[model samples]
Target: MNKSKVLLLKNCSTGLVSQVMTLIFQFLTRSLFIRYIGIELLGVYSTFTSVLSTLSLAELGFQTAIVFSLYKPLAQRDEQQINDIVNVFRFVYDCIGAFFILASLALLPFLKYILTGITVTNAIYLYFLIQAFSSACTYFLAYKRSLLYADQKDYISKIIDMIVNVIANILQIIAMVYFKDYLLYLVLKLMQVIVSNIWVHWVCARLYPFLKRGKINFTLLRSLFSNVKNIFAGKIAAYVYSSTDSLVISAFISTVQVGYLVNYTTISQQLKTLIAGLLNPITPMIGNVLATDSEGESKEGAFKLYAVMRVLIAMMIVVPFCVLINDFIAMWVGAEYILPASVVVLLVMDLYIHFVHSVNVDFINAAGLFREDRDNEIIAAVLNITLSILGAKTIGLAGVLLGTVVSQMWFWFGRSYVVFKLCLQADKEDYLKYWLKNIVDGVALTVSIVFCAYLNSRLPIANSYLKFVCSGILCEAVSVALFGVFHFGDPEVRKMLKYLVNHIGKR
Candidate 1:
C-alpha cells in the first residue's frame, strides 16, 4: 500500500473506533436525559447548547483554512513554515477567543430573546452563561487540535477526543441520574469541554513541540487573516443554516417541541458526524495529493475515493432508514416524546441531502476554493432560514425540511457540481454518470432491503425488542447482500475488494 492509503487506513480505523465509542456515549447520555430530566428540561438544555454553539463563531473559519494551509507545508516537512503557521494561527485563535468573550458578554442584553424557552430564573441563566463560557474555551482548544489534524495525526486526536467524551458522558449520566439538576448537568458539560480542550492542546503540544517555539510571523499573520475572513463569513452562513434552525424553532415553537426536534436532529447530526469522522481525515490528504501529484493521478484517486465514500454513505443512509427509528425512539425515550412520523421522515430526508452536501463540500474546501464555497454557504443560509421559517409557520417542521430540500437543489447541488468541475477539472457528464450509476444501484439495493424488512415486520414477534433486533438484522443482511451482488460485483469495486483481500491475507 502507498503511504497515503496507509495513513487513510490508520485514520479510518481510529476514527471508526472513536465514532463507535462516541455513539455509545451519546446513546447513554440521551437516554439518561430523557428518562431523568424529561423533554421540557431537555428542551432548555438543547436551546442553551445551540446558543453556545452559535457563540463558537469565535473560532471562525480559521480552523478550517489553517488546516488547508498546513497540508502542503506539512507534506514538504518545512519545519519553520509549520511552526510559523501554528504560531500565527494560535495568535489568531487567541484574538478570536477574546472576540467570543466580548461577543458573549454583549449578547447578554439579547439573552432574553435567545433563551426564549428558559424561564428568567437566575439558576437557568447562570447555566446558560456557563455553557457559553465553556463553548468559548473549547474554540481555543480546537485550534490546537486542528494543527494535529492538518499534520495527519487525527488518529491520536480521535483517541483523545473519544476517551474524553466517553468519560465525560458517563459522568454526565451519573450527574443526571443522581442529582437530576439541570444546572449540575450544565456544569458537568462545562467541565467536559474544558477538560477535553485542554487534553487536545496537551496532546498536540506533545506531538509537535516545535509549534510552541515559533515567533509570530506577521506576513503569515496577514495571509492567515485574509483567508480567515472568507472562512469566517462562510462559517457564519453555514451556522445560520445548521445551528440557527434550532434557535429559530425554539423562537416559534414550544420548548418541548424544540426538545423533540432537537432529539431527532441530534440523531441525524450524530450520524453525519460519524460519517465525517471516517472521511474527514482524508480531506487534507486529497488537498496534499492535488498539490503534489499529477492532475491525472489526483483525479483518479478522487474518483476512487468518491466511489468508496458513496458506498459508505449508502450504508449510513439505508441502515437508519431501515431500522424503525420511531420504534427505537419510543423504546428508548418512551412514547410520550416519540417524534412524529412526518418529523422523522423529514429528518431522514434532511440527512440524505446533508450527506451528499458533506461529500461535495469537503472536496470543494480541500481544493482551496474558499471564496466560491463561502458564496454557496451564504446562499444556502439565506434560503435555509427563509424557507424554514416560512415552512414552519405554514406547515410545521416537515415544511422546514421541505424548504431545506428545495433550497439545496439550486444552492447546494449546483454549487457542489461547479466546485467538483472546477477543482478536478473533470467533465460534468463524467461526474454525473458516476453518481447516477451509484444512485441507481444504491436505490435498488435500499428498496429491496427495506421491502424485505417491511415484510418481516408482518411476522409475529413475542417482544418489541426481539422484533426490533430481527428487523435490524434482516435489513442489514439483505442490504449488504444486494449491495454486494449488484454494486460490488462491478469490475472496479471487485478489483478494489480483491486487492484488499489479498493485502489482508498477507497481513
Candidate 2:
C-alpha cells in the first residue's frame, strides 16, 4: 500500500480502538453517575456539559482550518511554513481562551437564566466553572494536536487520548463510588482534563522536537487571525444549530426530560462517533491524494469511500434495535429512567439522516472549501433552530427530530452535494445516477433482511436474549448475501471491492 493509505488505515484502526474504549468508559460513567447522583442531578450535569459544549464555539473553526491549511505544507516538507502556522494557531487559541474566560465570567450574573432547570442546591455554578476551565485547557491542547492530525500522525494522538481517558474515567468512577460528592467529582473531572492536556502536549512535543523550536510569529499570527475571523463566525452559527438543541429543550422542557433526551442523544452520538471513527482517518489521506495524485484518481477514491460509508452507516443506524434498547436500558438503568418509545424512534431516525450528511460533509471540509460550506452551515443552523422551536411546541421532542430531518434534506444535503461536486469536479448527472442506484439496492437489502428477521421472530424461542442474537445474525447474513448477489455484482461495487481487496493484500 502507498504510504498515505497505510497511514490512513493505521490511524483509522487506532481511532476505532479509542472509540471502543471511550464508549465503554462512557457506559460505565453514565451507569455509575446515574446510580450515585440519581436522575435529576445527572440531568443537571448533562445540561451543564451541553452549555459548555455550546460555549466551545469560542475557539471558532480555527482548529479545523489550521489542520487543513497545514496539511499541504507539511506534505511538501515545508518546515518553516508548518512552524509559522502552528505559532499562529497557538496564539489565536490562547486569545480565544482568554476571551472565553472573560465571557464566562461576565455571564455569571445571568447564569441562572442561561441554565434552565438548574437549582441553587445543585452546584450548577461549580459545574459550569469546572466545565469552562476544562474547555480552555482543551482549546490549547487541540491547537497542538492539530499538527499531529495534519501530518497523519493521528494514531499517536488517538492512542494518547484513549489511554488518558480510560485512566481518568477509572479514577473518576472510583472517586464517585467512594466519595459520592458532586464537588469532589467535579474536581476530579477538572483534574482529569488538565492532566490529559498536559500528557497530549508532552507527547506531541516529544514526537516532534521541532515544535518546541518554533517561536510565535506575530505576522503569521495576523494572517491566521484574518482567515479565521470569518470561519469563526460561520462555526458559531453552526454550533448554534448543532449544539443548542439540548439547551433549548432543557429551557422549554424539564431537566428530567433533558436527562432522558440526553440518554437517547448519547446513543445517537455514539453511533455518530462510530461512523466518524470509520471515516475520519481518511480525511488527511484525502488531502494527500488531492495534493499528490490525479483528480480522477482522487475523485474515484472519494466516491468509493462515500458509497461504502453511506451503506455501512445506514445499516448501523436504521436497523430497529429498539427492543434490545428497551431491554438493555431497563436492565441497566431500571424502568424509571428508560426513554419513551417516541423519543427512541425519533432519535434513531434523526441519527440515520445525520449519518447520511456526515459521510459527505467531510469531503467539502477537507477540500478547503470553507466559505461555501460555512454559508450552508449558517443557513441550515437558522432553519434547524427555527423549525426546532416551532416543532417542539407542536410535536414535543419528536418535533426536534423532524426539524433536523427537514433542515438536513432541504438545506444541508443539497449544499453538501454541491460542495462535493465542486471539490471533486464530478458530474451531477452521474452522481445522482449512482446514488439513486445505491438507494434502490439499499431498499432491497433492507426489505429482505427485515422480512427474514420478522420470520425469525415468530420462532418459539424460550429465551429473549438468544432470540435477539439469532434474529440479528440471521438478518445480517441474509442482508450480506442478498447485497452480494444483487448489488455487489454491479460493476462499480465489484471494482471498488477489488480495489479494497488488492489494497489490503498489498498492505
Candidate 3:
C-alpha cells in the first residue's frame, strides 16, 4: 500500500469520527437553539454568518496558496523554506484579519438596509463584534494548521476540533437552556473559538519545535503571490456561491424565510461537511502526486479518482433526496419548512455541483492551475450575484438558488477542462469518455436506489427512524450492485472491490 494513501485514509478516518460527533451535537442543539433564540434570531445568526462569509474575501486564498506552497518544501524537510512560507502566510493572515475587522465594522451599520424585514436587536452589533473577534483569532493564528496539513498531520487538527466543538457546544447548550440569550450563546462560542485556535497553535509549535519566525523570501513570496492572486478570486467566488442564498433571501423575502431555508440547508451543509471530510485528506496528497508523478500516471490516477467519487457521491446524494428528504423534513423540522419540489431539486443540484467541485478543485489546486481559470471564476461570480438578485426580485427563493446553479455550471466546465487539458495534459476525449461513463453509472444507481426507496416507503413502517434505516440499507445494496456492474471493466473499481472482499473474509 502507498504510505501517503495510508496517511490519507488515516486522516479521513479521524475526520469522519469528528464529523459524526459534530452531527450528533448539532442535532441535539438545534431544538434548544430554536427554543432559546427563536426563529427570528436564528435567522439573524444565519444572516450574520453569511455576511461574515462574504467578507472573508480578506482571507485572500493564502490558506490554499500557503498549503500548496508547503507541499514541496515539506516533502524535502526544508525547514527554512517552510518557515518562510509560514511567516509569509502569518503576515498575510494578520493583515487580513485586521482589515476584515475594520471593514465589517464599517459595514455593520448598513446591514439595516441590507437585511430587510428583520428586526435589529440591541445585541446585534455585539454579536457581530464577538463573531468578528472569533474569526480574527482564527485567521491570525490558524496559519500554522496548514503546516500540519501539508505534513499529513491534519488528523491532529480534526481531533482538536472535535474536542473543542463538543465541550463548547455542551456548555453553550446549557447556557441556552437557562439564559435563552443569543449573546451568551455567542459568548460561549467565542470562548471555544479562542481555545481551539490556541490549542492548534500550540500543537504546531510542538510539532515544529525547531522552527521559528522568519521573513518571507522575496523571490518565493513573489511566485507564491502570483498563485495567491488567482486563488483569492476563486475563494471570493466560492464564498459568494455559498453565502448568497441567505443574503438574497434575507434581503428580498423575510428573515423568517431565511430561517425556513436554513432548516433544510442545515441538513444539506452537515451532509456536505461529512462527505467532504472524505475528500479533504486526499487533496494535499493530490498536490503531492501532481508535483511528483508523470503526466500519464497523474492523468489516469486523477480520472479514476474522480470517476469513483462521482459515482459514490451521486448515489449518496440523489437517493437521499429522493427517498428521505421529504419525510426527513416532516420528521426533523416540519412539513411547513419543506419547500416545493422544484426548489428542493434546485438545492440538491446546487449541492451536487459543489460536491463535484471538491474533486475538480483538488486537481486544479494541486497542479497550481489557479491562473488558468481565474477569469472564469470571476465571471461566474458576477453572473451569480447579478442573476440571483434579479431572479429573487421576480420569483423569490427558488429563483435565487437557480441563479447559483446556473453560474456553477458556467465555471464547472471551465475548471474541468483546465484540469484535463492544462494540468493533466490529457486529451479532451480522455476526460469525456470516463466522465460520461461515471455520470451514466451514477444516474443508473440513482434510479435504482430511488425505486428501492419507493418500494421501501410502501412497507408498513410507522417509525421514521425505521423508515430511514430501511431505505438507507436498500439504497446502499442497490447502489453497490449498480456500481459493481457499471465499473466491472475498470481496474480501480475491481481493485477496491477485491480489497473489500478480502478484508471481509479476513475479518
TM-score of 1: 0.85
lDDT tens digits, residues 1-507, model 1?
Answer: 998788778888988888888777777788888888887777777776677677777666777778888999998988788888888877887787778777777766775675555665666667667877787776566677877777767777788778778787877888899988767777878887888788888877777766665578998777777777887867877677677667767776556678887766767777778777766766777778667766565555665556555664666465646356777778877777676667765666566666655656766767767777766777777888888888878887677777677666555466656655787677778778756865676576557646765667695887998888787777777666666666655666766677779999999
Q: What is the lDDT of residue 193 in candidate 2?
A: 75
* Tens digits of per-residue lDDT for model 2, 183-239: 777787877777777877888777766764467887765666666766885677567
- Whole-model Cα lDDT of every candidate shown, in order: 0.72, 0.70, 0.79
| Clash totals, every prediction | 0, 0, 0
Estimated TM-score per prediction?
A: 0.85, 0.86, 0.87
Best by TM-score: 3
Residue 441 of model 2 has an lDDT of 57
Candidate 2, 414: how far from true, in Å? 1.6
Q: Which 10-residue window of candidate 3 scores lowest in summed lDDT?
A: 298-307
Stretches off by above 4 angstroms in model 1 are 1-10, 71-84, 115-118, 140-142, 200-216, 281-305, 308-312, 357-359, 423-446, 449-453, 481-507
With candidate 1 superimposed using the best TM-score fit, by how many Å does residue 73's alpha carbon deviate from the native?
5.4
The global Cα lDDT (0 to 1) of model 2 is 0.70
